[model samples]
Target: MSFTVNARKITLSLLIGSSSLMLFACGSSGSDSSAPAPVAPPAPPPATPPSSGASDTNELIKVNQLGFYPASQKIAIVPDNGATEFSVLNSDGVSVLDGELSQANTWDMDGRSVRMADFSALSTSGTYTIEVDGVSASNPFSISSDVYSDAHDTVLKAYYFNRASTALDAQYAGDWQRPTAHPDTQVLVHASAASEQRPEGFVLSSPKGWYDAGDYNKYIVNSGISTYTLLAAYENYSDFYQTRSLNIPESDNALPDIIDEILWNLTWMQTMQDPNDGGVYHKLTTLNFEGAVMPHEATAQRYVVQKSTSAALNFAAVSAQASRIFSSIDSLSALSSELQSAALSAWQWAQQNPDVPYIQPSDVFTGRYDDTNFNDEFSWAAVELFLLTEDTQFLDQYLSLNVPATTPSWPQVGTLGMLSLLNNGKELLSEAQYANVQDKVLGFANQILAEQGNAYQVGMTRSDLIWGSNSNGLNKAIVLLHAAQHTSGDAKPYVDAAVNFVDYVLGRNPTDYSYVTGLGSKPPLDIHHRQSYADNVAAPVPGFVAGGAQPGQQDNCSYPSSQPARSYLDDWCSYSTNEITINWNAPMVYMLAAMESAN
Candidate 1:
């Protein structure tokens, strides 16, 4: 089960199925470049006939409000009963395509059966709107070959925008510029974090990382998965990422932009582990969530609080993965060794303190990523360490653990171990072992695809629409992509399923808004992010993906309905439904990049 330095380089031949779907030529030509060009303003549609019976007040199309891929299925929702036929008009008021809507499933939120419009045949590169007979035209959308390239760039750049201890200038940050804040060199070690080497008052220099979400706290569990996703992106698609730049402070570095951005948080994550025993702090946070103030304006004292089995195991997994990845990179070889050492030591610490979990004190009110389950974390660490060091003991531990095949999440990380085994553990694992891992991955993907009949036509089931529902969808997409890479069967269904999840986030869902900021025609303007609220800019930072529609109104904001997909608000007060998180955006970046690269 273990691997050695002499093991074969991980080579993946992703056999994506391109046969089920036909990629149509873009309707409007001359926009073949990777970056989108400006288009003529959309012309108004002709007046509708009264006999068409379409609701003139309601917008008919539901898409990723930003736009669609030239060859991808572009779905639209007709909320009211009326004409089943629709028209696609180009910017110059030319009717480019006309089609009849197939009656899709009914949604519980409004008791309206949505009619599906297939505009995938019109693969034209132009600004256009959808018209449903007598209904009002949809918001303008563009069809382009490179529709998601800029979106991929912006989502990755969001991590840099959320970087603490760094000034965001006009050059990269544009109008959302801010002074440097949270220089955490003097961060106090809380009572729970007191150890033989570092007492309660001990100070540590943990200066940089993206804030956990809308709040300016850092959670090791969350960051571990987020960083791993970014690293996985680089490992899987290095060719696409090697020269890709978002004009960050480290854009000129020899490392790929993705690696450079991940390093910013990796450096901070390194500081979370105690050099004395390799126990990682659960979180570095203020006593309570800070007020809605700019980073420079919020002056609360921060503390590195508690050490838990979850934190140690998470650190072990990420560090081990990092060690394996950076071992080959010339500039990061030394850091790789350090990370490997730290990862092994953290795994050792967790062995002695397996039952320890994060317990928030009575006064601390910040976000808690507390988890009682350590089995998944332990399995993940063992698999990662085994992959890097090829140590039989870690491999033995991994085999003994009952790792789950679920998608990667902060709490459930057994899937991370499963992915590594299926992706890179091929040389080390036995034929039966590889088959077992592959079967598990396929099982998860099949489960997701099985739920495709939900009202939204996205792969997510009703239960998946919880807090950070968009992340749930994106994580599921990640699972499907992995399955597509490994499956011997037709991969188109899995790939299309993954794309559906991304489309849901972009604007294809019932909410009619892109969960990500600044991409869609209608995006969350008042997301519960502090910088977005404090900055004088008209739009929120462009790429931060909001935690999507949650039926549970966990915060104060009033929601229109309790239906799974209808319970979202763009209000700043709706933290449960609208907060932006680094973990949420990481998988989004991965999904977008995967689709872009595949194309």
Candidate 2:
């Protein structure tokens, strides 16, 4: 089966504001000042109108919203009339750094020529803001070594905030607490899923997985890539994640906080596979999407939909990766063996039914992560199986497919297979094979570097800004980081490029709004998340990264411009622009962990 990437557009008939409008009424009584002889308090100094400098106007400063001090930092300023002079002011309102903006021939997507000032020379740690003479001062930012540490934990904990099946108590969830929802212990098998072994109406206990996105659904294909990224983070940076705690219920558990969090999803994923055969359900979803309500309020029965080759292969690949990672833990050896057995079984099942693809029934209305292309999935699974078991047949199958290197998306993950093989399976490959894989990796990295140089210092190209474009940037960064581990000649450029991509998502973009919720100076507030919408909290749940700017206004919300970076709305109504998903956040965790580890 082959699947094409399609953007899911949802039309909302009524736009319900996520925020409440509060009106304050002030009544002054004439007798209130009866003690006038005491001299009316000095008229409060004339109220200073709030400065609109940070407003989306002619003058703007784009930097990482969380700020930077330990590394070289560049501030992008768009002056009203090509003004050259700019000043950086400390929190004390005293000038700290002064420089002239270097005019650039390049123009932003919105037709504004972007000028740059390098304040990397000023390494002193302090809270600061940028002043462009006529424009209002830029938003205050901090310059310290640990500036992003809190944000790193916040983003990682976002997964906990989105956990299903378990209630998020105030103890861990803080302000985002909510009752448990989607206790999928008695999921029904869909009619289309009826097989010779397990017929329709069979009840399965498929409980516990992160909601796919803002919608309360779980998908295997998306979960595969998401779980793989998280595991890769643990694989590469065990030391960094082992001691870091996200304050989850499992913080006191014997396993690292990261491992505990991964297990929350892995346990649910394990249930998605059919024990009778190695087949896996594509997704578990309700008949239709729930409205803007809390998890407990959106009570809908879920059904495990039809099995697909993609799902089976995805399951196999992720299980194999998990098997390798968990084998080292003394308590998890048995579980590791189980995953390895499941992976091999799933691979065999997929081999027999290679053409099985996901087809959403007419009765089902949800985001269909449908992919007709199973070749990449096959390659990925085969590579993992080969690496885990040292099986020559699996390696031969992977080589026979001759999968090319490409950027990884949920639907297209052949490149991830190549990355895993190059990063971990080199000992099993012949010299020629190793060279071939190495060349491909370098080729892909070179392309990304060229794109970065041409596109506003960001690693993604204009075409990359599709739905969930932020993930595209982060996913590309993941590939680059992996490549940097192998490349010998000055890996700093690759690491810096990867860091720049993360910086863009954090707050260093034209929009000046951090795509992640509840972290930056102007983090997104109205994320299109149901729990956040129904929780009655003043802020959305922290750490979930939004699907960045895309020209396709699928939600029909008004955007400032169609330009990639400018086409975003921080409103719950803008589902296409603001919805968060596990796949998007997974790479974020990888990127942040990688950066922190490097530091």
Candidate 3:
């Protein structure tokens, strides 16, 4: 049946009854902390006589709450243990600042006090205040100067593990030290901070090649869905941000039109799928300590040992990417029949298998898969599918499915996967679908509100349920809220929460900084294990043949201690540079775009 997928244009106003009051009351009051002076604080009051009974000695003082260490000069403040929570305000009094410990609501679960370890940007130095849970600890501390030095080096020594290469090794050295020739490197050397040196080309080049000879098993690609979707994101990033060109060598001729290239990629994915159960597989030879393959068995995503790589591939990524492909026929008819046939066949397959949709958690082959929560990602995919094919079946499936309760304990992938579905579903579903999703969305949102505390930020891919702090989770929330705004009325809470997080990131003092406390057990946010990102780059180890290392040594592909030379783009981030694919960057780009829009 033909249906219109322009849910974006569908206008359905729900007079959410007064009985629907529960939806409106989302968000916890959180801990009551002393409010700081405005971000733009007024000139200090005349040295007032110590307030009655308020002991000036109870106050504490510090310069800046957060900044690159050694660069930002410290300030001083008088303590006041009279209040319940600590508060920091800007010099002029207005903007709420971040990164203070021993204050109310400062811990992010696990009782680890949150503090500012790095600053990626800069705002004016300001006055600050603090309190330890309702009792004022400090009066005022003013930061006098920036502390980051000229020789500040943020480059991290890391490993670059490659999946195809079947080995673990050290990272390239140039990643930290700039090359003499690159222009950006020169600018970075002179600039006060790495974030400030925005170069034109690959100026942030690093040296130090990785040693990939260690015996280890690499990551396996999930042919069913994740890969295709990631590919689409990869395609979008390449088309919009980096270079608007498509060059496939084997194709001989480059497709000038990006849409065409997208289609080509989509077609290619389908062709690779298992004809029987629709599984996709990729092959890599085994390796040894010397990086030599033993030529035994082929290892892939869960369902391996298949005859070939065909059946393993699915349309996971393509579903999200396909709608963006250019077309005129309401749904284009310009594509070749083979292409159309494959696309339609896949769509049909998805439709027929609605009860057993490609829920990521449903891996019959591998019992050891990650979180078994696929409803969220599936809901998102349904939205995309509906938008592309105008399929109501998909919409109904999505709206009818219940979104699992999300918590700080959930994995990042799980949270984002579900959030993406909530965020994007409205753009393609029918009014019923839209309303149902909106109500459900509100329910999910209320869950977030009900548990919010100043210190309770939902972790994205790690531990702790910190809210609006996770870059990835923020993107998901922002987009879903955007979709909600387009469907329902103002989703300002979601919008505000998202903007606050972005503002927090953007308002930092631009100086040398660090993030030692990672989200979960993976170390700090700044930890640079470069080798994890080089999966696509490394060729099979020279000595490895088929079945790489012995079973026990599969996970030992560690890298070197030194970092590699990097380009301007390379230096922009520590590890993500070498691993420039969709999974990592798509959410990032989406967040950037969203922030830009809000700005």
Candidate 4:
């Protein structure tokens, strides 16, 4: 989905199950930190090995291209046109397993009729295609333990590729390496963010956050959710990330690689605050969207503009979470304390300036993450502060609001606060308070899990297919997964639902393209990312999740179909459906790590 990155406001918006990231195609697809860069990052192994024995490979028969975990649910969607028995064919065209198909059913999201080929009974590890008697043969997919390892790593490495202010050394960046860009040491304080201490045009050195999306700009509202999601991932599954290296420059550091990556952005986030007032800038960007060019080639005046209640609260929430998370590490203890202080300062500024919202200036034109309601932001930030300081006043503020728990997005984050409470509040809250938080969280998770009733068997409804539908899907997985971990009951249903959503993202959805670039079959090659477009490299960076299908073609791009599920355009014009973002990739990273540890 390629459109101008500034159009990001238009949206309000997988898995192979091997040992980890079964929704992703897992394997040793690249050299590790100790190895030399390849002439090109190895093309992810084709999801399907060639079927030499002669049978058309049909694109309509969508399965998880990375395949399924041996024990996970394995249902392939086939066209509803009278297909009864389906055959699972090995690469040699030999039938390895056979199953009866479910009756054709219409999916309201797309009005496309499809049937399910149940093959969960087949546990053999091999690359195979599903052949329906009348419809067609599907893409090749492998079933094996740890089938998604390589894919998991590749997606996480995408962040490393998107890092700003640093030259991507060939040893780690491979052929994708580029010169340093947006050092951010010479940033201007826009008139909107000017204060008594710093006027308009004040030079500030704010550097090192990941580019917010396909755009080169960075937004605090977006980064807050993105950073918090990664921290939650690391907190929930520290064991999974401790040794999983993307081979970035810091892979050998004492801290976990994920922490190193988060720190890069966290440091930048800390700079967005005005040291004088504790108010935070909404975003750092040029006057207009830059052309598709390498980061080093873009030359424009960058400014931090507009202080808002939303931005300040987001800053407070993320910084508080970071402070608590890093306080345990001796090397980061002081940084933790500094972050804690900043969080409190930001919280105070928001209390004093509770209604300040971002207003794009007359001269400046960029992506505006404008929002009106600050309830979710306040609750989230307050809960985080409560957790960080062990101060009941912060907890009291959060609980007094009695905010309804909902799924998370940059614009809606109360659920994240609730998630944290469910995750860490039992020890701190009264039994009634803990149970109330638990009910809200588990209830939302149940709501998402119920979406598995759809014909596709993924926990996504038509409403879920928004601007960044892919992230919506994965965020649902995050909720179901948290439920699975929080409950003492059978975790299989929750895990299965989460796995099914991963499968949908990988290749099981209406569009056979795996939403992730470079990892699964027929991925979106020309994703709406500036770096990938301008890098001169033929392949887009691997592992960045493309914004999936949605009916609102806000980018003015042509579509294969108007159906919400098939409204995806893989070209650069389809920014509404094809752009990649830190927020989108964060859930993917979280879900992948969670899946790896699910077993």
Candidate 5:
């Protein structure tokens, strides 16, 4: 999350997907056959030794909102002009504050300017400045605190609730906002109270990215992808943890309150089910409660089972976990069985429709299906379902399926797919089947390594390497390293590649913990570059554009017409709150578990 760039510690940012980077321009290596070999350039000058003049030189500094807004609020002493060092220091004295900006390099320095270092901490409220040598900037320049905001605080608390317990809403959050398109939409569903209270596994919700109504009989429901995920998490928290029996702490009530939200989600998900098929529905449109909501084959969207059912199954797991503590089982069994059945049906459908491209009227997957998560969904669903049902046949079919060796240019999501293969494939499939799956999965990893070229160090630009492009390549590398943890066969090279990718990304944007860097519909080439999430906008730099030059630019988010992502550069090293809570934590835990299990 944090990096040491130029002799100072700075935070980094999070990335959405991996980048296929072409970092250094392909120019003459200066090894001409006709000319003599060129000598290596002299190393840059070393940093000016800490001013030897005095232990505390009396130098006063003032804030000037010269180039940017918010003024020089939290500027700290950096190594100035050297690579390979970083740290966050205090004003008047070089006291280091254990802050995220000290770790992430990207936010620490905004294109030759260190503006992100100017913010109030969440725990303590004050304005302090950073000092270099004996000179001190205005003390009003620095601020430190533990709490970011009320809303962020609530979100973080709910996230940890899922992490500590059985991933109550985590699965839904993971599958709903899936990084890429893969089959598994048909079976994914939201959690029901039964599942949340005494979960056996996950539930069946409609495809992510849509809203969920409280109706279970309706085949299709209208929903917003992100909101449904948030609502589900909150509802699950309240269902089991909010009760007086749990004795949640006053200050830590955020977790229990979130459980209440999950319970609401269960009731809401049930209400959205189609009475006829017993399938979950997306909730994004207005409906007349009095009339018949028939299944409109062409209008109704279907996606892979995992996208549709993981939320529901996750609820089951939550229920199962909570029941262990609260002693509630008979109350939750029937609904749990129903959710389990729905998820099973969706999985069967996926097995039957391997070649189906998008989430079509006949298919379960909704929205765009051409993404990295597609294969991942299949592997995850198959493994989970196989475990729940003990259906070796399912494992056979999953192993037999010929997943394409191809992976999208996007690295973050693609890397996840690789992890899924590594985790689920080995967990469920037989030795032979696992080997086969590994063969196919390795092809995808190799594909990225091939494109990386010299950028192998940084790997590829997550979304795109050019200007304003957001890249998840570092994340992809993380997943790859995880996958490589088990099994053997040239995995070391892949692991090395992943490490290099992380190093390069962290080196360039040291302050950002998340390593993400793009906004709008696609990745940005630089800080100033801009792009829209909807229409195809002009790329500021020639030959620099992301998502290709295709017509009808897709929103950065999979959902249509979603708001463009904003670039908050300073994210490197605060904590793994958001990233770990959602994308990073589960997968990291799952991967580490697999590694430990293997050992």
Candidate 6:
């Protein structure tokens, strides 16, 4: 097997010795070193409107509704109803483990005063529930070694559900099969994207990429981060993903399933690049948004809009990064060469036309992923190029800007550069340079933990509950986990905080619902996904992470509350709260794959 061939392996345990992390108390993996001392938790926030009071008695206790990995942290948020202890009961109604609850702490924004119940001491494999003496029992959960395996595959398969330009065969998609849509062999070249070689209305053959979101379109800027995150996961966890098969059309190929799915989009991304000048189109789409209908029914003319510096630099970054990894395998030598050539061409174009932004035409009314700032894009492109070639000029460009790292998103991608560097830059940097890089990474992780004093005890803060807050929470966890993996000393505090953030998205927050569409005790059936709505599937597409709660209420749906964490609406009209996208699911895939590989 080629599982162990890739470079760069780290051997840090996931939160080895936190007070609440005894999932490995009976195990033999003493390979884990001792972790950092626990930070002194801040005083509890005052009980107020945005936070629930001590006397309130609504069902707000939340845990990971799916289950636990048996060798990781296990925690549940319980209401402060004078309960001092909690117990784990087996499915047949027998008590198995008990633990004292932490002091009552009020969440500053989500409106819940709660105590923590950590039953990680229980490692027996069985279905169970957490029960507080005076409060309602929690949703039933299980403890097992293989708790996340199926979820790892299901969430990644969601990419297949979002594919364009091909009919989904019944053998692969089962009931979700549908006809082909948007075969872009005749994509019109818009006037803004025109040149002498290819005038306006040029019919070009550009086909195959996943739909950017619930809307049926392809965007290079959004695809850039989503694709890079998945590739980053593979680069770090190559051993776990080598032979891990996803039963898509290319499952039987010699390449790994993740690479196969990624290639499906990468090929389309390549077509978006113009051979004449190397500028990449920002998006390939119809003039307007389509109505709720099947893929074949909503027939419309598609066009490739204006080329942008953001899209070109993103293309440069992803392609250069991919070329390096593919070159590692002898079988992919040809693809490696081709991707690098495309990347170099894109980099050249970006250098020449460095300020182009996406200007949506007057007639087009689809999603606009416009960004005016290119500092992060430039930094990320330089870093990936440096990694691919080990050129000091590229390294100098990266060092000159000194952009700060944060939780990565489509528009804000400076952190992606830091993550890739942390993974591959150690052997290339001097002693001081590497140390400075490490400090920046760890400093961001420390800031995240220091700011997250809410009752949930996760890594998100009051300002983080914006649109797609779930992705922010998961991306924050990714940062914390990477900090733990790459830093030197006891890594327990960072790892523990990361695990709690994962628990938050899986159903430990104020909403009391698993943010994932499926695979939890309480999941949303009415997601704002066009395919799920038009297909008449009784269940929404499986394994999607919803946008999560925000006070914006942009969709103006019937929301239960106006509080930031409680603004979620699980109906078709609530696009702000319930919509799903590739960028959101990408981090979910990364987190699950990382934890599964760690186990």
The top-ranked prediction according to lDDT is 6
TM-score of each: 0.90, 0.88, 0.44, 0.90, 0.39, 0.92
Candidate 4: Cα lDDT at 506: 91
> Which is the leading candidate under TM-score?
6
Q: Per-residue CA lDDT of candidate 6, range 6-44, in tens?
A: 364566744322111110100100111121121332223
360, model 3: CA deviation in Å? 15
Worst 10 residues of 6 by lDDT: 21-30
lDDT of 2 by residue, 180-231 (tens): 8889988999997888777888888988889878877888988999999888
Measure candidate 5: CA RMSD: 17.2
Error of 6 at 355 (Å): 1.2
Q: Mind giving the per-residue lDDT tens digits that candidate 4 earns over 1-599?
A: 01011112111002234301011100111111111111211112222222223223354698988887676678888876555788999878899898888876766665666778889988788889988765556878988877777888888889888898899999998888899999999999988888879998899999998988887788899899999999998887777777888898988889998999999999999999999989999999887777778889877889999899999999999999999989988999999999999999999999999999888787766667677789899999999999899999999899888888776787788989988887777789999998888788788878877777867888776556766778878887887766765665666677678778888999999888899999776888998888888888999988899989877665566788877788899998777788888888999888777656543
Q: All models: lDDT?
A: 0.78, 0.75, 0.28, 0.79, 0.30, 0.80
Q: lDDT tens digits, residues 1-599, model 3?
A: 01011222322231110000111000111111111111221122222222333433422232222332222212222232333233455556553544434332232121212222212122345554443443333334333232211111110011211122222223222222111211111111111111222322212221111121122221112222323333333332332323332222112334423233234334434433334443332211111111122211222211121111112212432433343443422444444333334444544544444333222222121111122234544554454555555668765765565555342111222233334344454455456745654555466565444333433232122111111123334344444443444435655445444433322222211110111111111112222122222233232111110110011111122322111100101121222211121122223333333322222
lDDT of 1 by residue, 444-561 (tens): 8999998886556777654566667788789999888778777888766787788888888988887778888888788889988888987888789889998887665655468866
Off by over 4 Å in 2: 1-59, 73-80
Q: Local error of candidate 2 at 117, Å?
A: 1.8
What C-alpha lDDT, on a 0 to 100 scale, does residue 209 get in candidate 4?
89
Clashes of each: 11, 6, 132, 25, 187, 3
The alpha-carbon deviation from the true structure for residue 428 of candidate 4, after best TM-score superposition, in angstroms, is 0.4
Q: Sort by lDDT, best first.
A: 6, 4, 1, 2, 5, 3
Quote the positional error of residue 13 for candidate 4 in Å. 33
Q: Which stretches of candidate 5 lie over 4 Å from their true place?
A: 1-92, 95-275, 278-283, 286-335, 348-380, 404-428, 436-478, 484-599
lDDT of 1 at 481: 78
How many pairs of residues in model 3 come into backbone collision? 132
